[model samples]
Target: DQQVKQNSPSLSVQEGRISILNCDYTNSMFDYFLWYKKYPAEGPTFLISISSIKDKNEDGRFTVFLNKSAKHLSLHIVPSQPGDSAVYFCAASAFAGNTPLVFGKGTRLSVIA
Candidate 1:
């Protein structure tokens, strides 16, 4: 079974709108979570991240929120643009350093103009 789950396989939002992507994890050991955005035929790139200790982290138009009690997290993008369309993957790491990350099946996001 997957340790992490994106639940939604795809999402669509109009330009200048807000897009909310959700993720849930089954493993309690996970202490860190990161959101990765991938384009066609390209590798996933880090977008935003949050630690178990932090409930929310924001970077410009992107914000990541962690709900430890629910083992859930969400990525919010404000004013979603066409360029923001891509596959988003949620990843979790248990210990610090180079530990292997558990990844959820990515969710493809389409930002329509």
Candidate 2:
């Protein structure tokens, strides 16, 4: 079974609009969650994260909401720009600091100028 899944492999939106990406996880042991963004050919870079203790976390134009009861999470990006076009991956780790993470394949966001 896919412990982590991003059902949609790609998403498209116009510049200055809102973009939403959805993710789901089956493992209840996952206590920490993270979102990473990647440009072509580069490793994913950390974007935002939330511990299972919090329901939501926001960072400027990016926001992540976690619903532990439902095993669901989503990322929202506002004022999307061409520069924001990239692959986004959702990861889960049970522990903090150097623990390996389980990753969803990724969702490619295309922001048209």
TM-score of each: 0.97, 0.95
- C-alpha RMSD by candidate, in order: 0.8, 1.2
Instruction: List model 1 lDDT by residue over 1-102, tens digit each.
Output: 999999999999999999999999998889999999999999999998888889999999999999999999999999899999999999999875257888
Evaluated at residue 66, the lDDT of candidate 2 is 97
How does model 1 score by TM-score? Answer: 0.97
In angstroms, give how far residue 67 of model 1 lies from its true place. 0.5
Q: Which residue runs does candidate 2 get wrong by more than 4 Å?
A: 96-98
Worst 10 residues of 1 by lDDT: 93-102
Runs of candidate 1 exceeding 4 Å displacement: none
Clashing pairs in 2: none
Query: Candidate 2 residues 1-113, lDDT tens each?
Result: 78899999999999999999999999888989999999988989999998999999999999999999999999999989899999999999885525689999999999999
